[model samples]
Target chain A: MPEAEAGTLVLDCDELEELAGALALGAALPQEVAAAQAHLDGCPRSHTDVYELATVARLLAEAPEPVEPPARLRARILATAREDTAPQDAPSGIRYPVSGGGGPVPGTARAPAPARSSLPRRPVFFLLAAAAALAALALGLWNLQLRGELDQRQERLAAQQRFIDAFAGGGRSVAFAPAPGQEALHGAVVRRAQGPALAVFTALPRPAGSDVYQLWAIRGSTPQDLGVFVPDARGHHIATLPDLTGVDAVAVTLERERVPAPTTAPILTAPL
Target chain B: MATGDGPAVSDPDAALLARLVTRDEAALAELYDRHGRAAHALALRVTGNAETAQDVVQEAFLALWRRGHTYQPERGAVRGWLLTVVRNRAIDALRGSGGQVARVLPVDTLVLAATDNPEAEAMQAVDGRRVRAALAALPPEQRDVVELAYFGGLAYPEVAERMGIPLGTVKSRMRLALERLRGSLRAWERDA
Candidate 1:
């Protein structure tokens, strides 16, 4: 058993826990480090544990860049905003005050109107006919505008397809095998030549918290990282990899960052 | 560089975001000019399809225009929030299309210019690997917490809710996870 040296306070599990918490919160000051160092200098056993915890704290300070939203999403959201501005005449579920000489409200019954003399029925008829013609014209114009917008959208889509065919390179087919217990992740591979190429998707268990599945390519001695990918609420994911050649196998493992990379190994490996 | 301009301002993204909120067409183009490359790179990285990534960039900006009001500076920085949304959308697309995994050629295999010398592409590839390795080395509990917060982009409370754990546990786990990652990265830097 490791013994504490004389004149130094030996930290137990409780003290180590406190230190870990402080380090994680970035609340561990230089003074704390000095105090820890002084204690560690006297008690070597506590030194390694405290130092390791402190290092993990430091890495958390510089977290990786946050994930970015897609481009078309902004357009879609803007379109939604535009839609919100359009007038909606849905029933408001409230009763309005009736004005003088008006019949009963829409939901209420009313007495019949009395006979009227000297009213110009032809002018009222003409007004109604004119209003109908204006409505028809408005409808025609609206239809034309809608058709034009639809045509423009289709043209843009066609242009995009052409651009993709010219610049995105010819697509290729690849196969991937999931790690041993990840039989659910088995899927087909689509390959692109330029840029960050390679992606995989499958239905699997949703990882706990912010943890996501990371893909790795193992070739003999080297373990190359693809990238981190998260599955949806339904436990489905599509993972992308950095370009690499001569990869013998691919694996998806639950990964999280650690200070002073630990000697401990991976929890899962899906061999592909 | 334009003549007579003072020192270049850092992070014009807020201005771009504000203009986007107002539905300014020119501002949208300028926003693209400023962040398009980075956004494109990220989209390409996540989707592994240049065409899709390009589309994703366009779509994300459009979303910014429509949902700009939802942006609250109190929640986080604009860039971080935008990136988060973009990544989520890209992932949603990949899932929809049933994209493949393990087909990517390594970054070193590409013949693109290294003009940025120590180009972000190369660095991303290396750093991504290092980060992966470091993540793999964490304890299961701590690793899961860190993963949920970073890659999954869940808030601390959300992580707790998803994991069915107490909020305090999630926070502590996150703290531990970050500490471990930092230590590993430091060691990695030293060795490099």
Candidate 2:
């Protein structure tokens, strides 16, 4: 976004510095990332310096203590792993009850021939087999949940991409940044005469309980509430406002649910 | 190539990977049990939500399962590799299709350092706490720059504007802070 030339495949010292900065920021566009990779691949000196910076950046990314995934997630991961890796013909690898006739159970492979005749059949085998089946079902459900989430993210990205592209062709774009010492909220707004004005924000801090961050289009003393939005990971929030004609300013406020007007102060405001 | 403290009877990450390559589900489970929490935490921090974090973890581990053969022991520990992949996926999700560049990732800098012993050592030697302590020790202004750039995921100019500082100041602070962190981490590596 700062007008760094991304077409250069071979980077000079200045380019290398720029690349390092981009990498640290995780703001490298696809081409920039490739160019940085090419430069690092070709130039060996001080490459480690760049690598060290990346390592440090990565460490900072994981600075927060790890949180345990839900129990169902673990089960789903394991079940999917087994279901994927296990061959259809092969036994589920989970030992099951050998019937009195010494044949394969309904869903599982049979025990070894020699053991089948000699080993005593127990009721617990059925229970274990049933439990294993249920676990597999749970894992399938969990996998579905994961897929649904992936689809949602994809849909959001597609919608944002469309919104951005349409505005990029002909529109006025305003970039927003946090006020001094404030890092929780930053974003941009794009307005096009032919379409609705779109605001795409990132890292918007969550309001305390039941409260939401509402977007307002300000004209004079009166502020129009555009809509309420919550952020996704990376604090991204996007809203398409129906009108933008003669809007003097845009601001975001932390407001209570269903409030008719601005009950409190604005967290972020930018003049149009 | 060393073992992370995990539940596996055979502790080395490489061994687990070998098992994984053979389609051993237990091996995958062992690796997850050992590193899943950290991976999830990193994803949650980057994505800012539990659901997205869950998706990242699911995708990352599945990638490992399907591509475990890609793990080169000489690169680094499996935990480090896994964390890197998880972080990348989360970034991709955050930035959308624009983020998925099929090129060398920032983390690949470490992998490419096999010929450079000192650089490779910086990556292999430092663990989570060492890096955390180094970060915690940075000056507040310096730390803010690093966190906003890396964790907050802003471009350099944006970071400068957000902090209300000059572009030059943001770049200098980042370079200086990184130098200190690299030095501290290298020292910790040597002491260890």
Candidate 3:
């Protein structure tokens, strides 16, 4: 084995270990590689070792080309875009025009209509008036129906907004209510946060096999695991997360316990 | 906020992204045209499948629409940032598809196979096959450690966790593995 000569390099086995650790992490320093290479020149064993490692590194840097995406994905994406733009259930409102056509221009030429001097019976006017009244009534009813729908939609939206706000605040406590006619779990908020510190909890169906629930705090660029908790026999449980400040979102996942930490991807998330 | 004469549109990405934020279908289509292929390629490489890669790319673009405001141009070019996003999304897809590790071939496979092509001019300078064969000759355990670290792009702690071994053991194995591989590759080169 070609060994590092006495004065070729100052690094010891422990130093080499650290270098290996860094290399394994893909965080190896360029200077370290150069130093190792220089040392290897005088030491045959070291030279061979460093060279092989370099080759492997080069190979990794130039891995095979990735697979191409299929064409159908574009259609799916566009469909989602269309769904997002679909109008909500808001009633259409009419607005009076503000000023454009100057009050009948005085100099504008007007075509004269042929004169109808004959005055029909008075009952004809009454019949016309009655028809107009009926039309007005129908219009009123249509407006009322639209107003009613708008009011209902507004109420539902307000309730949903409140729920989302409560979650964003990190409600103080959470409770899980069982879903109707189902053995699974449903979550609810008991107390809402004043700002962005609300506490929330959900009931998850008891995990089958060897799985546990993992909580995560996702902010910019990375996802941090909050912790793991197991649900009780009733399949209801609560896990308190740290402050939600600067965290863009939170999610829960059913993961294998052996994994120990939450993966970068989330399995399920509660919309906030 | 503006770069003169690079592209006709000022802050083209931001302008398009703002429209996307409002759920503008046309703007989204434009973005897809601009960076779709590269994003798809990255996703495919990381996920190792065409279908999953497509999903990852779509998900990544959707995420960009949802979170484009958070992007800071100071960090790097938009293309790099997008690539990073696609990479992460692909990795996430791989992880979510269950605990089974994605099958990524060792880099040596690419290098060695390249050398076999008769028309390749670059192969004349470097005997990539010999180097790859040398790597293959190592003990399976050591080879796996090296491959997972370098090609899999996994950190030491991750490799340790994946292999169910101690961190110290992983480091030692890597050092020994590299030393042996290097020795063998050098011997092959000299003999040739």
Candidate 4:
């Protein structure tokens, strides 16, 4: 990282343009490299200037006079490239089948041309069709990746909205204390002074097969069974609990299914 | 398919690049016949050793053969792309071998298709005589710094260190010399 202009932290347009000249050959002392890129990203004119200058710099790559290369060098390079056309067959995903540069190893043949034509019928047409299909496949995969990203963003947005709604209700939050040896679990019970309550958990251990975390409302000595809920892949669950009328506490236990009564000890407890 | 070291009139190089993607060895040979001398010259200039230059050129051609599918026509001409690869590989070899490059004026040419004059060739070769003449036209100091940075593959500061000049001087001289070269190439195309 070459130092930018001395005593200056931010570069102006003029300074960036001055740097663009050197950027042609990647000779710019861009300790301010990030700033230069940011400038190029925003300024179309300077971006084009840098590109054109780079093309000019590239021209310097040609020899003024010229010298012929060794004839044997040409033969060696072409032969090696032809051999490299074979697909490297690595049976184990963890390790390459072969290492180092040379001709194709045994058992590997140059990947047979596109699979569209076994019989040589209209070879050109089949080749074109295969190429078109490959291009379409690439485009489809790119679209699928974008859709996945969009879905994740929407999910995050919905989660944030839920958090905001809970906070805006001005409810008192009761922390759900985890049982000993299960400190990774955390939850909270949000209740308005006189309305419905909500239960949210994070890092909730996913129960074993055919099991769920059952919720119970404890009033005095009696425990009224609420319902069962499962956590998402990230070990998070949020659900609105039933009316909290006269309910002094809440408890959760891992159970095989919704039971009429408590089957085991509470894994989490929260006081109203 | 046209293999000759003459002026480029049509888009023949594009066909050669397409052939390269298909693993056609004859196309590779034809391309080598056309540009191998120039590639070798550039490599030798940078690495300062004929043997090292040969290796660099060979590696560059092999890389072109392997990575041809990744080329985007929108970027620029095939000849430009080929020479850039050769220059980069030579620089890499020079760095690895710790070799030194002697300073001289560096020349460059890119013939944009003559939009205004259809009679003009798509790419006019600026022969060695004209290239050396353009190099001679530059101020000695400006030309020297341009050669050191462009051919030596050194950063501006390194050019400064080698020439015993301030870093700013090296930067400005390089800029001027290259800008002038761009102008000269365009002017020569018009003259041709």
Docking class of 2: incorrect
> Tens digits of per-residue lDDT for model 4 on B78-184?
66657766765666576663322211111111111222233222323444455556667889998887677767867677888999998777767877776787677
Provide the lDDT at A103 for model 3.
10
lDDT of 3 by residue, B40-128 (tens): 76566667788887877777676555445444443223443455456545655765645442222121211112222332212122333
Q: Give the candidates in order of lDDT, highest first.
A: 4, 2, 3, 1
lDDT of 3 by residue, A60-108 (tens): 2213332334567777877765554222111112111100010110111
What TM-score, over all chains together, does every model reach? 0.29, 0.52, 0.38, 0.53
Candidate 3 chain B, poorest ten consecutive residues by summed lDDT: B105-114
Among these predicted structures, which one has the highest TM-score? Answer: 4
Write candidate 4's Cα lDDT for A1-272 as tens digits: 23334322345677765755465664654234334544544555634444555555655654356777788978888877766643222211111111001111111211212123244333456788888879877898889998998787667646644663574377677777655434346677877566667887765657656467778776553455577888988777887888776777787766544543343446677878
Q: Interface RMSD of candidate 3? A: 21.1
User: Ranking by TM-score, best first?
Assistant: 4, 2, 3, 1
Question: Distance from true position, residue B157, model 2, in Å?
Answer: 3.8
Better model by TM-score, 1 or 3?
3
Q: Model 2 chain A — which ten-residue stretch has the worst lDDT?
A: A96-105
Candidate 1's displacement at residue A148, Å, is 33
Which has the better DockQ: candidate 1, or candidate 3? 3
Q: In model 1 chain A, which range of ten residues has the least summed lDDT?
A: A98-107
Per model, state how many residue pairs clash: 59, 2, 10, 0
Runs in model 3 deviating more than 4 A are A1-70, A84-236, A239-272, B1-12, B99-192
Q: List the residue pairs that clash in candidate 4.
A: none
Residue B26 error for model 4, in Å? Answer: 1.1
Q: For model 4, state the Cα shift of residue A65 in Å.
A: 1.1
